[model samples]
Target: MMLFGHGDGGGGPSPAMIESLRIMQKNVPGLPDVVADTPERFFKHAASRYSGLPRWVGELYFELHRGTYTSQAMVKKGNRKAELSLRKADLLIGVFAQFRILHQNAA
Candidate 1:
């Protein structure tokens, strides 16, 4: 998260995000792509279970911002809801990211 922001000082992605993705993939073993990238679709598909999400999470989405807001504490990474680093996010959204590039397909 810090790496996504300009003010966290030093840069790239946090180690935690990387490991989180590894674990999720490890656990699920080839999770699907279309399922992860389209959260609205996911939310609707699982509405009964997820309609309770905070309004912000359901309303907002993923986008890459290059710099921090100079005046506001809303650092480049601030106020992000479904936000994930592009690297982590690509993987988090699953199958969309070719982390290992070892296989042409992953679930």
Candidate 2:
């Protein structure tokens, strides 16, 4: 499928681009039918036509910006560390509250 747009860098298709596509769709001889369609519809049609297509059951990772991998990994690690720290703090707080309740009951 020919994707005609700015794509991941994202400015979208310009009027000139759309016009060109329209012209090609109408005037191009012996060309395969060119229709601008949503990716979802395209995939759905593909899935319906092709049996035994392997279904992906995980995160759809876009590897477009491979350059940012290290930085993104660092960010993910930081987030995980912070999440663990927060969980520990929550557990400690819960324990302390229980201890305080026990002490008050014993007094």
Candidate 3:
């Protein structure tokens, strides 16, 4: 039996990659079954889901690389960095809002 990717030399997805995508499509949480047939649809569903989340939650993924999820150490580091950035953004927003309130009261 010929595999889909063997000897194609076109840099297309390997068998393992296809298998992983199949697994992800079948199991990814919050992904609609209707959109699970292909990688592009799966990604579109994922992006739409992420976009609907709170700003800070989505901000946590602004610079995210999916590869981070492949390793425990990388996941930890990525989570920490995302948390730090979210905290910083929250603090800055609070400070700016306070400033605006103070300025309005003074005026």
Off by over 4 Å in 3: 1-71, 101-107
Q: Write the per-residue lDDT of candidate 1 for residues 11-106, one digit (tens) a residue.
A: 645678566555665547575422223456555767777777665545343454443345456554454543655667667556634454434455
Please, what is the whole-model Cα lDDT of each candidate in the order they appear? 0.50, 0.82, 0.64
Q: Compared to the true structure, candidate 3 yields what TM-score?
A: 0.28
Give the candidates in order of TM-score, highest first: 2, 3, 1
> Where does candidate 3 have its weakest 10-residue lDDT segment?
1-10
Summarize candidate 2's per-residue lDDT along 1-107 as a digit string, tens digits. 77877756888899999998888789488888888789999999999999789889877876785677466888889999999999998888789888774444544
Model 2 regions lying over 4 Å from their true place: 62-65, 68-107
RMSD list, candidates in order: 15.9, 22.3, 16.6
TM-score of 1: 0.24
Model 3 per-residue lDDT at 49: 75
Question: How far does residue 78 in candidate 1 sit from its true spot (Å)?
Answer: 14
| lDDT of candidate 3 over 8-50, digit per residue (tens) | 3577777796776677667578855422255667556767878
How many steric overlaps are in each model, in order? 2, 0, 0
